[model samples]
Target: MTSGTSPQANAAAIVGAARRAASEGAAMLFTPEMCGLLDRDRGRATANIVAEADNPVLAAARDVARELGLWIDLGSLAILRDDGKWANRGFVIDAGGEIAARYDKIHMFDVDLATGETWRESAAYTPGDHVVTVETPLGRLGLAICYDVRFPALFEELGRLRCDAMRIPAAFTVPTGKAHWHLMQRTRAVEASAWVISAAQGGRHEDGRETYGHSTVIDPWGDVVLDMGEGSGLGFAMIDPARTAEVRAQLPSLANKREIPRSAS
Candidate 1:
């Protein structure tokens, strides 16, 4: 979604997307990261973004999930923290509108780009320390945010845990997204031998931030199932467990993996 600045506007967008998903018989609907507000305006973000307890956008999304009878993966919401930091958090909402699983993003995107694109997420957000995987109707879904996609070990461990799919919610900058987004997604899917669902924020946001908008889903075979091109929209893909099984059987990379002990050398 084009999250812009208003939480209400974002919530309204989710409702509309949910309706469309329901009509098209999509059992699940996923939103992008920081679904509430994507403001680089520090003061505006501080004033608008509230704690999860006080976030109406989240509450409204829950209501929409229940109302539409759709399992909703709320990609992530950047909420205010007591330490005056941001909590980039994710949630899997059941069809009943109840939160089934919650995950805080572990990897922080603190970078200094030569293109004058600097982001100091750790300055404004407290990073999560643990990996999170949860059971879902589709399969065991591992949760991660944008920057977390770069960590191969995370996907390796999730494969060890037998996670069937990985959910990534991101708001990627255009330059980096064009360069690395699809590559990372395809690579991760092949590495983990798991389905990958990457919901992304596309186009320009209200805070003058331009995000790479191709939200994509990859099967265990590393085939792109759905790619919502550079735009503000949503799409559906059929996820099959048997396909994952078939790919694993043909490749068997996960089963063949042997970790070497460093100190033994």
Candidate 2:
């Protein structure tokens, strides 16, 4: 879902999407980054959105998780904190309406693209210090945001944690996404030997940002099981634990890694 820079409206849209996913028999629902607000006006956007725990949208998401008896993964949000810094956080709401786990995005996108696009997330948000993996009904799940997808070490850690699946929620720029989105996503899945469920913000937003849509779910074999092309709607696919196990057993690359030197002297 493409979120405008409105907190209330975006929260409502998330709740609505959760209800729809539940109605469709999805055991879990996932949304994209900036699920709350994406405003170019930094001050207004920060003021309108929740940058901390126990905010309205988090509460509403927990309630939806309870009502639907399904897991809800709300993509990264700008969490306002008293420390005067924002955290790029993701939530994993268990079926019982409890926040089972949370993960802050570790990698910050501090790039100056040649296409006249630039972003310095570190200016407004503090980077998370650790990699997090959460246990779920399906399997251990790794959490990551947009720019984090480019780092293979993060996925390596998740693989070490025995994660069977990973969620990469992104609001990718049109240029980058069109060039490397599918290739990178499929590569991560194959490397980790885990199913990848990527929910993305498609289309242009009020912030004048165009996200490359085509939210996809890839099987452990690195095959696209479902792809919601450049549009706004629900995409669905079944994630079987058996498939993950089968793929790992067939090709155990994770167990065959060689330790590398930490640095050059």
Candidate 3:
């Protein structure tokens, strides 16, 4: 859905997306990273962000989920932590408005691009140590956020958990999005032998930042089933549960894995 700097505007976008999903008979509403707010200005971001206890976005999501009976993957929000940093967190809400799981982004997107772009996500967000997985009518969902996608071992660990789907919600940079976004999703889906649902932030933001927006959905066969281009919109695709088993049987990489101990020097 559309993500600007305004929380109200972003909430409006969420409503629009939910309406679209409801009209289309979609079972879930997956949103982008910082779907509530994406601001570069520290003062404005800090002012707009709130603790989860007082977050209107989360409350609205619960109400919408209850009303529409739609599961929501509220990507990541810049939540104010007690340490003066915001937690890059993702939440999965069930159709009944109950939270199924929450995951703080483990891998921070701290980097300096060759094109002069730079970010220090770790400076403002604490990393998570636990891998979160939860079950719903959909399947076992292994939750993760933006920068975590760069680490293949995370997906492999999820594979070990027998997760039927993996969620990698992101606000990726333009360069990285163009270079590795699609390939990353495909590779993960194939390697994990599971569905990968990625909802991404697209276009220029209210804060003058551009994100590589191509919200992608993939199948176990390593095929991109849906790729919503660089725009502010929603796309839906059905996940065939049986396909996961079929793919695993076909490849059986997860089964073939053997742990190698450290060599004694």
TM-score of each: 0.96, 0.95, 0.96
Top model by lDDT, which number? 1
Expressed as tens digits, the lDDT of each residue in 183-263 for candidate 2 is 989999999999998999898888888889889998888999988989567878999989998999999988887788799
Candidate 1 residue pairs that clash: none
Roughly what TM-score does model 2 have, to 2 decimal places?
0.95
Query: Where is model 2 more than 4 Å wrong at Cα?
Result: 51-54, 261-265
- TM for candidate 1 is 0.96
Candidate 1 on 79-143: residue-level lDDT in tens?
87778677899989999999998888999999887689999888778888888898887889999
- What residue runs in model 1 are displaced by over 4 Å at the alpha carbon? 82-84, 263-265
lDDT of 3 by residue, 105-177 (tens): 9998889999999999877778988999999666999998988988988887999998999999999999988
Better of 2 and 3 by TM-score: 3
User: How large an RMSD does model 2 have?
Assistant: 1.5
lDDT of 3 at 15: 71
Residue 189 accuracy (lDDT) in model 3: 88
Residue 265 displacement (Å), model 2: 6.6
